[model samples]
Target: MTKSPRFMQIKTYLLDKIESKTWPVGRRIPTEAELCEQFSVSRMTVNKAVRDLVNEGLLERTPRLGTFVCQRKAESPLMDIRNIADEIKERGQLHHSEVLSLKAIKAPEDVAMRLGIMLGGDVYKSEIIHFADNTPLQLEVRWVNPNYAPDYLAQDFTDKTPNQYLVDNCPLSAIEHTVEAIMPNEMIAQRLDIPLEQPCLLLHRRTWSGDQLISAALLYHPANRYKLSARTSL
Candidate 1:
């Protein structure tokens, strides 16, 4: 318990830098010596935090160079974001989805807190695997506010993506996305056909149509096959 908070503090500091885009990918971070001074911590403490991030694919260490933020596996625009289905179609790839589960359930605490609903309130949950040209590309797990999409569980996801349906039905005002690298569990690893050693790009998204939170989603992609890119005008 004593070591937990200190290491977490160090980890949170670095993660905040990456998540806020303050320390963009490819930017070399401060050396361990520098971090020790900045955080007033010991070398071993710094090493533990840094090593954990390296394993998560957030930081890369070179033989002589200091640690740097590694590239994200999938990129979306900072302002405007496109639905995954449309992105695949634009690339001329055959896009298909396999809906694994669709049903109404009580909102989990984490989800309810984000959606501004009761902890046990009804929410529609959807688990889907998206394929690009027959290759497993994404595992999409989404939680929907039934108040926004009452018929979410009744619709067939294979015909239209959960994201697309929400876009069509809701009046969107804001979208928030947080990207992180995560090592998958056995189930996710097997489903993605990727080894546990490989880090997966995990994107957490929350959508709001005006004042109502519409949906929250966790999107996962194998790191080797996916990278987030954006091209936009100033």
Candidate 2:
């Protein structure tokens, strides 16, 4: 076969480094001039290649900070999805997270329908426990649409909550929230560091960008440890 276009060659070169983690998440990539010099191609071609990767979520650009290898700001609990960190900061308490699990799994029927993907489609799932002053505050269980955030599985959420990451990386257009009281299961109770008999508050939230379902989450908080509040403006 004939050799591909210079831009294609350039794109593939950068993609290889990213996938192999040579350019890890949040690692700043070379500038257009740098790539132009390396590939001996015009700046326009390099820019086109970089722009394509950015649109694919493989690269991200900041106004003054330069482009970096995108981390796929996926689940791993956009760490402050519950705004737990901010709440703790406001109270002058230290905060952190216990990431229970992060992986890629085939979506079940109900989850697929809610995420607007076909059954068995790829989805990113994560479980996390948010802490306030070293006390468990909430257990966040989330499923993310892979299409919206293609590198979802490669993200490192140890330092941030899924909600915080997504909010920063992906622009959201809509949200639906529901809250109810329930007795958490054995696993959830243990993660929340509470007894199964204790009632828990479940916040089921579905987020979307326009008509596309971006993610669905179940935030479970111990009734005694946490309270739910809402604000409204008329």
Candidate 3:
């Protein structure tokens, strides 16, 4: 096997320190010169490692104070159907949700296509806003196949998220996701408490349970306040 890159090795060393709390958040890391001496590497190699960490949001550079570990951006896995509430709780923050609407409705054309149902078929629709530490984080507009989740509209979303309830009833077997960045419309802007011109990330997701399409959702988040990340190894 080929040897790993020198910069990658240095990066891993720094990451190990941060993850172990040997270099806790807000604690300034050693200077490039110091790292270069300690690793017996060139200053350019040390700079590259630190720069990569900064770009990845693990370290931040101060004008004259040096680099320090910083609190990471709120993140969700791009390839996973994770519960927003659980993610917030894992970060040691409070999670709250508000149900804007929940009722049965005739499936709209787009919703019908996504859920693989008739255009006018009966379906359950719900709109909810999830908050992390009372700051709006996501707006979820979902349409569910009544056959799969008959009691979807009856449950209180504030007490439990739609995702949580769906998992219990639907037992997700497959999921599809499409992500894009777009300027929020008036209502989306107002709900997310951001200016209309500010860009937002939109995730269109469709889920299936045992080969039956169960639910489709449009999830929106403020671009600056939330991030999506995915990791994989061969």
Candidate 4:
């Protein structure tokens, strides 16, 4: 296995602390000198870690001011799964999507385990940027278990939402969702028309049909413009 770099490891450690709330938002982190001593690395290494986190929107730095933990944005609920087109229609807005990529690829280890398949199993991947009223809303990255949806790549995603197509073609039993807050990478930032330092809401979902995993998806949305909601009953 390829080990992460020293700077990356440091970044992960700091991120874990932030995520675990050890260092809450608006709280200043250890000074550069302090971190260099704690990690037993040079100032350059510590600076790199901290700089990357700032670029990733996990930390904020001011000139002459210390670096502080960033506050997590209020996330909307995505408890209920809905088609993007339907969502926009319900809100009386125009919905559009551009197909970025659609092809078959070998599933990676993480994706394979989630789909309950071999690491190199065949899977269909689709990437699309969903828009509302000409403004980018979400970046939809999906992997379909070909066993369930054989012709997944042949459909015209520009005309129909993937959720709509799946609902029409595949029988679904249950769906799993994992939502998180993250900073957009260069690619995602460019696609979503947001700054790389802006935070984004990531929704990772897996759909199952009759005990079989059907699809896994990563939905990315700009935090400032997009919000999700869900209703639950006791």
Candidate 5:
């Protein structure tokens, strides 16, 4: 049998430690040099092992400090399209939003593809930061098909969320959602008030109203602050 690569072995060792609570949550793991010596491997191999863990949200790095096991994330159902404000209120927390941008713009390549519109086609865009009890909970960057909701740019998102407005105006018939754990970009990190190195749970969603594509949205949530879950009846 072919032996597993050294880096894979190292990664498995680290995963076992974290899963078993041998390196309990919030406890810092050994430095690269220490891991290299312990495993009798190059620093490059040890770094690869640790880096993968960080990317997976199993570990995190702090400047001027070592890497530590991350805390358990708060969960949100992955299949739900419920209003953020209603969800927060159900949790007994205040919900508010900051509408950073709301305007009609020429669609970029990705936005055009997602909305099934021609490149450079006119589309309504909005960037909003949603808060729960004063802490940033989500950063919503959305592109809307103006044909579906002509007044998308005019609504006051602070008083009513884009989701609520769209549900009322368009009446969704179908929806698609894709979820992943990813490192936040600078703007997303800044908007969500998280560090650039921190992992984030990204949800890409598309909605359709009676066979007409309505909106495409990228929702970013800080990984340490949030997680995605799912359940279904058999």
Candidate 6:
């Protein structure tokens, strides 16, 4: 296996200290000069590591107050289909979600076609914003075919992740995923706490179980802070 880069190693070391409370929130970390001495690396490398961490919301630098350990932001692991809550917990962070909207509504033309239902047919619509350490990470907009997965709207998403609940109850037979990078709109920007100009990765997915369209969802994540990778066997 290839070893991790030195910059990444520095980043991980800082993050581990923060997560372990060795560097508490608002605690000033060593200065760049001090870090350079400690790590025996060039100032450029230390600057790169600190700059990346600041961009990632892991460290806050003030004009003269210096850099301090930021409150831990929630982190999500890249793994095979797993619950977002579980991902956050694995990182030792608090997970919370807010239901921006949840109701039964008529599907739009495109959504109806995707779900194989009439444009005016009833569909359970839900919009949720997931938070890691109180920072929004994902904006989820979903539509459920009530005929296949009834009582979807009544479930408590705070206690159980939608993916976990659906897998356990609906047991999809096939899943389709489409990913793209696009600029986020004002609404999505507010929800994800990203600048409107910042690009976001939009993941559109549809699932089927026993020939029935089970669910369709759109997941949005800030581009600079989030990434998705996969491996396939041919």
Model 4 error, position 34 (Å): 47
Instruction: Write down the lDDT of every candidate, Cα atoms only.
Output: 0.85, 0.81, 0.93, 0.86, 0.90, 0.83
Please identify which of the two predictions, 1 or 4, would achieve the higher lDDT against the true structure: 4
Ranked by lDDT, top first: 3, 5, 4, 1, 6, 2
Candidate 6 wrong stretches, greater than 4 Å: 1-79
Residue by residue across 114-231, what tens digits does model 4's lDDT show? 7889999998999999888787888999999888889898999989888888888887789988889999999999999999999999998999888888999999999866666688
In order of appearance, the predictions have TM-scores of: 0.66, 0.63, 0.74, 0.67, 0.69, 0.71
lDDT score of residue 81 within candidate 4: 70
How displaced is residue 43 in candidate 3, in Å? 11
* Number of the top lDDT candidate: 3
Candidate 2 lDDT over residue span 1-234, tens digit each: 999999999999999999899999889999889999999999999999999998777788989889988643212132123456776667666889988899999999988877878999989999988887777878888999888877766777768778777777677777888889999899989898899999988888888776778999888988765555565558
Error of 3 at 53 (Å): 5.7
- What is the per-residue lDDT of model 6 for residues 43-78, given as tens digits with 9 covering 90 to 100? 898889999989778788989889988754444333
- Using TM-score, give the best candidate's number: 3
TM-score for predicted model 6 compared with the true structure: 0.71
Task: Identify the runs in model 4 with alpha carbons over 4 angstroms from their true place.
Answer: 1-77
Residue 99 displacement in candidate 5 (angstroms): 0.5
Question: What is the model-wide C-alpha lDDT for candidate 1?
Answer: 0.85
Judged by whole-model lDDT over C-alpha atoms, candidate 6 comes out at 0.83
Model 3 clashes, total count:
0
TM-score head-to-head 2 vs 6, winner: 6
Off by over 4 Å in 3: 1-53, 58-71
lDDT of 3 by residue, 98-122 (tens): 9999999998899889899999999
lDDT over C-alpha atoms for residue 17 of model 6: 87
Give the range of the ten consecutive residues with the poorest summed lDDT in model 5. 71-80
Which lDDT value does model 4 have at 126?
A: 95
